[model samples]
Target: MKFKSNILILVLLAVFIVCSVQSVSAANSHNFTTDDNFDTKFADVVNGDTFTFKAGSYNLTSDYLINKKVNLVAENEVIINSGDYRFNFASESNGSSVKGFVFLGDSNNPKATTPIATTGPTEDITINNNTFKYVYDGVSFGRYATNNFEFTNNIIDGFLRDALNLGGGSGHGDVYIVNNIIKNNLSAKDGIAIAYKGSGNLTINNNTISNVIEAISINSFNAPDLNATVIIKNNIFDNVETVIEDPNHSEIIDSYNVFNNSGESSLTHTPKEPANIIINSTISKSSISKDGSVNYTVKITNSGNRTADNITLTITLPNSLKYVKTISKTTGDYKNNEWTITALDAGSSATLSLTLNAKSTGKQTIKSSSSYLNGNETTPKEGQTTTILSVNKLSTKITVVVAKSAILGSTSKFKITVKDKNGKVLANKNIKVKVNSKIYTGKTNSNGIATVNAKISNKGKYNVKISFAGTSDYSASSKSVQHKVTASDLKIAGVKRIGKNYIVKVKNIGDISSKSTKVAISFKTDNKPGVIQYATVKVKALKPGKTVSVLVKFYINKIYSSHKRNVIIEESKTFKEASYENNIISIRK
Candidate 1:
């Protein structure tokens, strides 16, 4: 009986071991098991929520957009029957992600083969750790969304379509596409592993992409309307088919960036075709000063791998701006405004310095662009600013938007905007706009914007002169805009000197105005030793407010005059420097 019991215990032990092994096998095969369908779970997960799918192929319907951030995790090898952007998370939903699943976007939508069109704003999104197989548009960003997210640690077995479509719209969809295995994207339509359309500053690093029409592309809809900077550095594209090569000129700032390979190529990617051009260059400066002088430089280099013959580098000045081009590799005349350089071997560098002569002073601007023999060009409208010599460049650009009823002692509020011709917002952190006096200054808010509080005194005619102070970064500027504080006809009257004596006459011959008037004159002496002679001149009305002109003259001491030289009008006691003009004074000497 004891021997029989021992045999039974051994047999029971074996059974227990078998049962444990079976359970472990089941767990390894399926990460999570559910009895229900995947469609139901996909539809039920709220934003900022969680959803699970069992080990099976999910028959995807239409493209679903996740409004909230959620984790859409799946069992390994869980196939998405269709991958045509099956799941989208925009806006702040960038926190959302899809993990441990295979996306197959080749199948037709059960409802419609063509995706429906819907337009609006979208948020940023992130996609990672997913397998893409047999898909057309592996994934694409929409407009109005910034694509600074990543695609990493994923297996892309095949790209039946465009692997990565890098642009959507005017939105900031610039992205960092890194560390993904792109195998067989065979479609000839846009076999481009990644393509950019006006989207900018993408860092494509350490991504392995192969078997495509073109490796990378930087394309633009319109060069004049682009407003983004692109930088491409440190990426790898191995064994990619070269049906069509990108010329790299698609940026408003940087046309295209094909990042350096990790020394993977055979020291050679594609042979540079022989190219020719008489004039091709990109200037770094923006615009000319009000006096029409700008100091800036241009860069001239050979992008091709082959040596350029007779590399006579001529920067055909925009003929409109009239520039004198200069490069160290140049041979031509800087006075004549053309730089001819020696041949630049393939992959060589050259520099071109030029001085732009600005026509008018105000805020001068010009487009910065380049054209190469390989059909490479970069262009921008309203490119750079060239200040003449004033300090307050931004605040001087005043567009006095007036309403009908801005009367004396009343207040009005309006927006003051400063923009270059290219529609670029100029940076003016130190601009102040004052109305009436410094008591009503708008300096703490925005640039070139001044809030005004009007309190017109003796208002026969009132004028608003907006003066702009210069920052350390720019020059100063001022513009006088006219506004009437009164509803009646107002005219300016003047009084003649009292036969060049120490007396002056005053008169108001046009309309009935106030008795007190602010009189000013300019002196050539720049010395602040109180040169302005200030005294109240009262004139009883002769008729229609007219006073004797005999006592309106001012005289200086003979001893001071004997030594004083070139003492022309600088400013008077009642006048500020901003209110003075060139023709407002005369030299008596």
Candidate 2:
């Protein structure tokens, strides 16, 4: 029994040891650190190896050749500082991938090389999650047949030439470039974000591209013989000169792409439609009085090479204006203030004019749009013109003035004077006094003076407008004045010190009378103790536009001579004034 147990323990220990050895060999098989010659180390790796590099910088002096199907992955931050070409994948290196590594080239001489270049026929090559910066060309592939190539989730920036240049030659494959950010390749002639020339199926989806001369340039080498299919969708393109430059205009399916701040000529393609129609609308007058008529002209021109068939122009009028009649040639119905015209030819314009009467007083807009009746596949082009129709008020000369400046909560008399252009008074006319949308009506006397009384409560500048409706002899007019309702203001007019006696004059320049007002005079010496002298004089009542003098005597001391002294005349708090900022006067000695 002891010998059987010993044999069982030995078999278990041997199995455990074999498993441990295999685990260690698998871990060390495809892991590499930074070495002096990384290109040489990479060449020694076998086929189908998943080699991972540690976080460090590897300076590549010469181009590394990819001869077999392998994966070059970075564990963390790995950068390849290359001089010219970084990797040259041969025809036999099928299904190889390079991911999660940053490739940096010489910025001063960026036009000297590319980051990854494919020489011969390569199939199923994926370059993803890698950043290529300051390279001449980020990736250059073609000249031979390549199939099923994918370049996704990669960032290529600051390239002097094209970021992904797939040149023309014998090639039959589908090239997919998805979810990549390509920017700042500013070459005027050939610095495109993605350029394709050969006959292949190309798809660019969900990529962000900006700051390039051309975002995508597609040109077929042998046009009637070799045709390429391109599918571009869900990409954001900004700050690029041109979004697409398809010279041959191949079969392309493009939709749901966002383009902002790009050039005006975004898509350069041959039009498949019959005509391109442009509509323009103009008003005879931008502003007209109420019940006045305005002429609106809508010009529909077909600017395309082919004649437009069954083209329709629709004009929509605002509720403030009513359509009167059509003055020009029209072929459609005018109902519900909308005019429609049908049919415009190529390089010809159909001018339709309609007179509209101003119904109300405000700004009104006339909207007109035209479209080809063949289909609604394209958006209809629109144009608009705004007109302002005001009420036809007379243009008489009107003057609005307060009869006298009044106090708050007091009845103020406002006089409105209306005159015609010949300086004659318009008598027995109706005038309205509008104070902040509150209307007060009165009739002018024989002297053309309309008087209205209003209780002023708000203490601010009021825009008082006097309007005169037009009569048969005079035009309508309105004039406004900024009338200020203020409290009773008390001010010290003048101050004089004569023979140790201070005389102060107080005045009521405000519109109301003041009662029980006290004027005070005080002097202070600029010493450490600050000796002060004070006196007060009481005035029983002061009327508006009136003045009074108060006299106070103070004995001058030697302390007042040695140091600087200040004398101030101030009104007491018995009355509230309009402005207290100028109430006190200071005399410094």
Candidate 3:
């Protein structure tokens, strides 16, 4: 894009000099002009020259136009940076258009920011297989470039607003933009990446694009209705947004895509449709709300190109509302039809109704839901809908009661009873334990209550856990409560088998107080049929060394009636040094 139009005037005169990059295909040519001016080394040669571009930067503001059809390749690593700050290349009016060059431009242009525009109608100006870095505009197919070209496999990374633009005339230009990366930069004034305007066959396919203001636009807005049939398929518009608007040309056929669109205004789509949306069944409205003695009905219709069968409609209402359904069938029957909403289709409006009342007072909110089925359970097309009711003012009541106690014993039953507007138990409702695990477990009863039962096994100090969870929603209770269990609270209850089949006991035990210590009890003679002792009982006050006669019966015949077997009995106490005894008399027959 370096031809200034007027340069042909100077070259026409004998005084003008010409330089060409024709024989660039020769191997390993690092033939840099050792002279400050590279005029001698890079001048005049023509078509079919292959050259390689080495790894480095290039800055060219000089006017260098390809006047012949030549192949200028970027060798293993060739760089063209820093030159006469002007248009780098221009095609001779009718000479061959320059094709094939890996031109790496690093032009530090602070003023001229517009991408170099190709002038006039240039044909077969193929720009492919090159990596452009930090240039004014990577490459521009300027106004009216009717070139059947291939802009493929080029990585343009720079600071121009638009990495590429293909703006053509009405029903005129045909260009194929394929497989190129135009990213890593920004432009102030509509740096459109690719603006297609010509009325030509343009196929932009299979490439990655990112971070550009106007990434890809098929701008038929400026052109007459004679717009070009553009095919933009298989490309990623990652992190891009813009004015890509042609409501008329937005029908895209998509298949196998991972496309993410963040732009609110415009979007890009391919010409052929890959997937279409099929509505299983369509309803007149999404949802509705109603109050006292309300009736509403909608017609279910099939809105797809294909026929829908056996559509079922179900409605949900607030538990407060006692509803009556009057459908011809619980499961709807359908004929293969384009559209059919029974209520609206019935010449007049058919209706569905509900009879309702406020269960509680002072603003009640109830939600009813509904679902539609394909009528077949296994492959049913289903969706849910909900309606709500609001009561301005009403009367409501709740009752919480504790069940009557069974005679005061070691275990106390605490029942959490609840009643609705009416005093009736709604049994077997789930409740949570608001108290700590060490203290309580929210229990459920057959008669709709959360019963928290506590066993008092200690004496003296008492602590309480009040469980407040109830059985059901109507129960009106939280899963929280206060409880008091103490040493003096646990009944002095436990059994000791003094004689066979005789479980004798101690009395008057209460909530927990002092720590307990156990005194060992062992019978001097081992008895057959081993006896199992299940834990020791805590006794706060007991005679220390008194001969307490505890009856002993045996499974064996009671023999040796006089031989006194040493009977050992140990006692336990809290807050006292425990004393034991070997002085126990065996009462034998």
Candidate 4:
């Protein structure tokens, strides 16, 4: 057991020492100055290490090989003098980055050598912020299939053949050449800014090339199956023999690329017109009621020196609004919320009007913008807002008309009418009438009038109120009128029979005089229990506490022979009565 434990301890110690050594090697870094030999320092670097060089000039004795994936960084004003040979980047130097270095070439052998060249398939290579002066070729990849190469923010001057060149392989990946400045003072007829012979997607954007024989050249060795697409945009070329030379007819997409010499003999593409777009928007009404409509207008102007073509405008509406029919337009038709204009002259303007309805109530926004040439040129987003306010109901007036004076125990007729503030009659409206403690409810007729009948029981002044409850578009209202009730009640006093004639006496029991009315007397015989006989008598007038008598002739039935008979009196509509129970009297024959 002791020997086994000693073996375990030894293995643990060995593992710890090996891990420490691997950690140190992985994090290896070096700093060099002009006193160190360049070849010797480069040979000592392993993969994934960073080497920093101080500012100085170091002339290479021979070609230096970068065979490791390392980062080579230099301070400002560091110059590497390559007399005739180049710094070769081998296949093992993939994922390497070189930055902030000024490379000076041999001026005597400018056409015979390149400063930085690739010897094999090197990928994910970045060479940025470098200056190549008096070199035959700057960063050349010869006949090797390479991809994912980024060459940016570089100044290449006085190149004899090409500033940046790649080719000699069947498959090449996407290459991005951006923000580069390439020019030369010499008028070399064979000088080219960029030359790509392989097949892949090449994007050359935001680059300035001037005073070269050819700005860009793409040749796919007459192979149509490669399907290479070259996009050149936002590049300015001046004093060049040809802007682009595509010998193999590969797919080239060019836009917003400015060529200064438009009338050059060997120009391939037409110069793009310089134009600018301006958009302004407005609304007819900013605030509107619910279900109301507003007009949204968009005015597009070309504030540029050249005419703009194929301008498309789009309008975006919020969810609270519904799109209605268009009103008018100076140019172009609007369909599916989009409008297109074929052409617009310089300094000209166009207008479009659209009608929109408010579907709900809230703050709504409308946005509009214009684009041309597949978004190569665009106007800023212009917005305008409209507010949808809730509608308030209209004011209504209820007018109640009733008799000024009414007799006691009489039904008073009330005329209730409803109308709006503009005197327009409203029909089918609910009405409530309260007479003292009695309430009546009904709907108005087509003439906006409702009849309410209520009994006037008291003998003094009272109020008759008429109320109207509002609807969705109308408001509530109420009105009251003064009604004076007079006292006039008729009662039957006595009944006398003479042969077939009967005399009835009626009296006014109320304080006021009674109006002319009729009295009806009914007789019932005991022989025929279901038989009844009736006679009506007319009473002219009766003052307070005064009596009046009239004769009512009622014939008897021969078959009905009985000694007992019953006589009852009832008042007609001509006058109201205070008590009806005392109007009936019993008589015996």
Tens digits of lDDT, candidate 2, 174-241: 98999999998746666789878767898999999998888887763333355678988778889988
| Candidate 4, position 366, lDDT | 78
Which regions of candidate 1 deviate over 4 angstroms?
Answer: 1-34, 42-44, 83-85, 90-92, 105-121, 142-144, 221-224, 241-589
Clashes of 4: 0
Candidate with maximal TM-score: 4
Between prediction 2 and prediction 4, the one with superior lDDT is: 4
Per-residue lDDT tens digits for candidate 3, residues 371-406, read: 322221234444443443444321123233433222
Model 3, which residues run further than 4 Å from truth? 1-43, 49-61, 82-117, 170-173, 220-226, 246-257, 264-589
- What is the Cα root-mean-square deviation between model 3 and the actual structure? 20.1
Ranked by TM-score, the better of candidates 1 and 4 is: 4
What is the C-alpha lDDT profile of model 1 across 375-469, one tens digit per residue? Answer: 23222111122222221232224455544344433554434454443344445433344445533344423454545554444334444555556
Q: Which ten residues in a row have the lowest lDDT in candidate 4?
A: 380-389
lDDT of 4 by residue, 67-172 (tens): 9888888887889887787888998999999898888886766775577888898788988999998888888887776688888899998788888887547647
Worst 10 residues of 3 by lDDT: 337-346
Top of the candidates by lDDT: 4
